[model samples]
Target: MKRLNIGLKEVQGVYDGPEGKLWELIMGEQIHIGGFMESMVMAKKAGIKEGQKVLDLCSALGGGLRFLVKNFKVQGFGLDGTKTMFDEAKKRAQAEKVADKIEFKLGNVLDIPWSEGTFDVVWGEDAWCYVTDKDKLVQGAAKVLKKGGTLAFSDWIEGPAGLTEAEAERVNKFMKFPYMESGKGYEAIIKKHGLTLKSSEDLGPHFASCIDLYIRMLSEQLTFDALRIIGDNMEMFKGMGGEMAFMADLARKGKFSRGRFIAVK
Candidate 1:
């Protein structure tokens, strides 16, 4: 797939502004598909143990970090490029009394600020879609992991059937994604970085259902709340809805989807 010109600056604009809030309104604090349940599954599959250090790349709002800290008793460090999200994640972690367990840093994931072999697990959620150079991102993740460490993540990805160039362009533009990687692309990157690919599951059907659920929430339940978040711009709301619907259509066709991956260093 052709990459878009979009990068960290474009992603920061979305998360720092009302568009970010709109996503929170629909996806809740986690802001990813399958939310808590998905996080739990990933943690279990990765064999995350109590007191193990974890780095969450693109850790928007630190929801995934907090979840791990509270549930799995892991020490968490979050790195995100967007200041608004970085600050809010810290605040929320403090408010939830997990501040002591997690630290948030505002920086590019492509150049991770942490030292090599610093973490027992490297984690991400759906947020990695916003990253432009996934090879660099995965390389960074692998570099930060201790020997025998796990890299566990779920991401929005190009599906099995793939997207036409036009379809990919529209979806990437609306989502501010530079590009979506295929499951195989991720597996290759993991192996290229000296990590062993353990598992990769295509979650297209579940992702489509999540999109449908979000559409229903925006159109039926949270219409006014979403409008308020966007400063009550009906036109903008409708436009966003149209784009989301288009994404939903593609997701159903297996052109756009999500993937859950687990690899070991």
Candidate 2:
């Protein structure tokens, strides 16, 4: 999480390395907060059920889609920004035997390759925070959903009062987020997209706990493995620990937040 001179390209390089694998190890296959617990909560709140269609925008490795398909009997497609991620996701689908239930594609989230009104749901995880054009992403999701479908996602966001500019810059550079919105801020965007808001709540407390847990896992239990993952770069590891600690404190204080939203199309 250190803001290493690693810009976007170099950041991508890290993901192609042990850093990305470390994230998967701590966060499970659902590399966002709360894993399947979080996914189940959102699916239930959105009234997702068997036979519904879904389009998972920015769906890394098809984990969330597989979770829904296996649990709710829904079928879906996952769209991600990277083919490397999709390639791994495809393998996961086949290995998990969800290959028949989900498909993975590589494309831009802001400009999906699918036709309009193609899905019953448009879903994302924490990945959307990476997009700079948040409105365009929202519009694309809205455009792709059927009239009676749902739009559901959970994202890393700013809290109700928002982040200080300096804090925002530091967090963005470390987390690779272009910008983050608050629960209130994202609700306004959903309304603008003409989706009926079912629920828009700050899930910051849950994420705070998750971050704290990961810190504990790395610092307390998995130190050796984690050290190997980063090639034993003690300075980088220390920087990441400090950055994560800052994020955890912000989440606990309601400055950095996670926003969960469900909307009717």
Candidate 3:
């Protein structure tokens, strides 16, 4: 299982970039996922309410964590593989005046540092696509959850039958998504662990919209700055553009998608 080498540093770098920074500003709390409003709607539909203890797996810079805390009034604990991201997230939490409500941990998603059944909800944003093992990840999320605890996540997923190896390789190289599973695969894994699948719906059109927005943002907002940073590598820029375009096309046609999955332990 070859995983994408997108660490906390890389993710933070993207989020911290001039264009990336502007993006978060415009997009608000839902930083990484394609559809900010759609993802939030899904989370709310999943029954995440006020004052619940939630574990944010693979949290990067805690944008989603902040959303969960602010809107849902949930207490958030963020777990990320990189200390740098954790530190930055802590800073953000403090800056937002939610420091007392959120805790950041440098840990693995497959082997969470917290004890079992310690949280009312286990949540993730688009970050889970970087994981190599979906089963272990899902199982781990289930482990730390109390009985009837909710597991809600929005992720990039392979379409119905799954992606061809060639297409998978192409997408993985650019996006750093190691294993993109199908909806049925997710259903089977969650069901195997006694979780009731509450919902699994596609948001591919949103991906199409977002990819267009991102590409446009990169051009209008960050081309000069990015080129300066990357030494004006036109080939690299073109490659990235190609990948984004391909993603938009595929997602629009349902060859790939962003999906919201909500389940209960």
Candidate 4:
């Protein structure tokens, strides 16, 4: 698979700009597939007990941590690449009165800043697809976890048969992923990192429904709000709709999917 040469700063700006606003509008505050229900599933599978520390990689806007802390009573530290994201996440934590339960740091996921064995759980959401070095990212997660610490996350990934050339171009051009891994591929990545894989589910069906709902929201419900986020560029909706539909088709066919994994170090 080919990877893009984009830097962390560039990718951060993509999400920090109109693209991120659009995503928030479409995907809600969690910014991942299946939202709160999905997070609940991952947390449960990881056996996330109270008092455990979690390191959330690519924790944009700190939504994942906020959700976990509010529901599970975990201490969460979020590490993201951009100051813009770090600041926004911090602000949201404060606004939600969960600031004491969460913190945000600025750094690339591939080159995380924390010391080894610093956390009980290494968590991520849909954000890892933006990283160029998937192996290094997984290795970094392994590096930060305590002995037998869990790794739980959901990521947008290549599906069962993977993406065709044209499909890859369509997705990459719209989603800005440098590269993606499959669920089966990630099982091997976790195994290579010496983490025991508990379960791996291709949550493509769930994501397909989410995308379908978003398309319906954009086309039928949130049309005006969606337009405003794109700076009122009405024509941009055409391209956006095309991309959404193309991705939805891929999801239904299993070429693009939501891959969820739970593992232990």
Best by TM-score: 1
Candidate 3 per-residue lDDT, tens place, 148-216, comes to: 899988888887645667777788876656567777778888888878999987777776788788778
How close is every model to the real structure, measured as TM-score? 0.98, 0.94, 0.87, 0.97
How far does residue 77 in candidate 4 sit from its true spot (Å)? 0.5
Per-residue lDDT over 1-265 for candidate 2, one digit per residue giving the tens place of the 0 to 100 score: 1222433354455456687778887888887898988899989988888999899988877889999999999988998876567788999999988899887887778789889998988988887777767788899899989998899999998887578888888998888776777788789899999999999888878889989999999899988888888899999889999999999998898899898999988
Clashes of 1: 0
Best by lDDT: 1
Tens-digit per-residue lDDT, 1-265, candidate 1: 7899998999999999998998898888998999999999999999999999999998999999999998999999999999999999999999999999998999999999999999999999998889988999999999999999999999999999899999999999999999999998898999999999999999999999999999999999999999998889999999998999999999999989999999999
Q: Let me know the TM-score candidate 3 reaches against the reference structure.
A: 0.87
1 against 4, candidate with superior lDDT: 1
> What's each prediction's clash count?
0, 0, 0, 0
Look at candidate 3 and give me any clashing residue pairs.
none
- When 2 and 3 are scored with lDDT, the better candidate is 2
Better of 1 and 3 by lDDT: 1
Evaluated against the true structure, the overall lDDT of model 4 is 0.88
Q: lDDT at 14 for candidate 1?
A: 97
